[model samples]
Target: MGKAAKKGIFLTTSRFSHEAEDYVKGLDAKIILIDGERLAELMVEYNVGVDPVATYEIKKIDSDYFL
Candidate 1:
């Protein structure tokens, strides 16, 4: 046998990418870009049951604004 395909939380808006197709097809997470706080909420809403990997790339708000 061969190695199984790695599974991950695929996020995408475009229906073209394989990730997007998987997400839209309910095979993966449909990641819609949003604020950290908002993203957390959505994760909960979707019952992901895990902490999102926070990155500056997604939350571009200035540190000052976070306060």
Candidate 2:
């Protein structure tokens, strides 16, 4: 647990009990909890499983355009 103070802790689960949350919060370590839904979101956000099929770009003006 003391090591958490240095490296922190991350817990990913489908659900968390109030008691568990309270216990971790009471610890001096920095604890992060990510539920199943959030874990999935993070995976998608980071492109964990999906493949990059295509790319697109939008035209925008640069400072030179103004100049």
Candidate 3:
């Protein structure tokens, strides 16, 4: 078969596992982390739009990088 499409989700900085549980429910997606606060802060870090979704929190997901 051809290459499978990849999907993903993201975590807002300052957010622990407790708050992230809701959005991380049954769906499967990659978690992109917002490393810091303020638009200028995250903007210098990531190359994506950092808006309301980029709240002050964080979440984690598994990956093959460890294996």
Candidate 4:
């Protein structure tokens, strides 16, 4: 099988225990663990299930305009 078929993604609203993490380390298949905090960050970054309420921009006054 291809590498894609040998990989797994495990997501949890909570975190995995240290033992669980160590167990996967020795496994042949690649596994990605995504916990609560990281899951929220990913959602925001990808705009998966989030909405932007507002946007802001900062501006600097041009000194040349005054001259």
* Candidate number with greatest TM-score: 4
TM-score order, best first, reads 4, 2, 1, 3
lDDT of 3 by residue, 1-67 (tens): 0344355545455554655655545445544444336445757568566445454667687677677
lDDT of 1 by residue, 1-67 (tens): 0344334343333224555455546734333434456666777779677765674655566999779
Candidate 3 residue-pair clash tally: 8
Clashes of 2: 0
For each candidate in turn, the TM-score is: 0.24, 0.58, 0.23, 0.76
RMSD of 3: 17.3
In candidate 2, which residue ranges exceed 4 Å CA deviation?
2-5, 52-67
Off by over 4 Å in 3: 1-6, 11-17, 21-28, 35-39, 45-67
Quote the lDDT for 28 in model 4. Answer: 85
Q: What is candidate 2's lDDT per residue for 1-67, written digit by digit as tens?
A: 6333544546565778888889877876667877778888887789987787898998877988787
By TM-score, the better pick of 1 and 3 is 1
Q: Which stretches of candidate 4 lie over 4 Å from their true place?
A: 1-5, 60-67
Looking at model 1, report the run of 10 residues with the lowest lDDT sum: 6-15
Worst 10 residues of 3 by lDDT: 1-10
Q: lDDT per prediction?
A: 0.52, 0.74, 0.52, 0.90
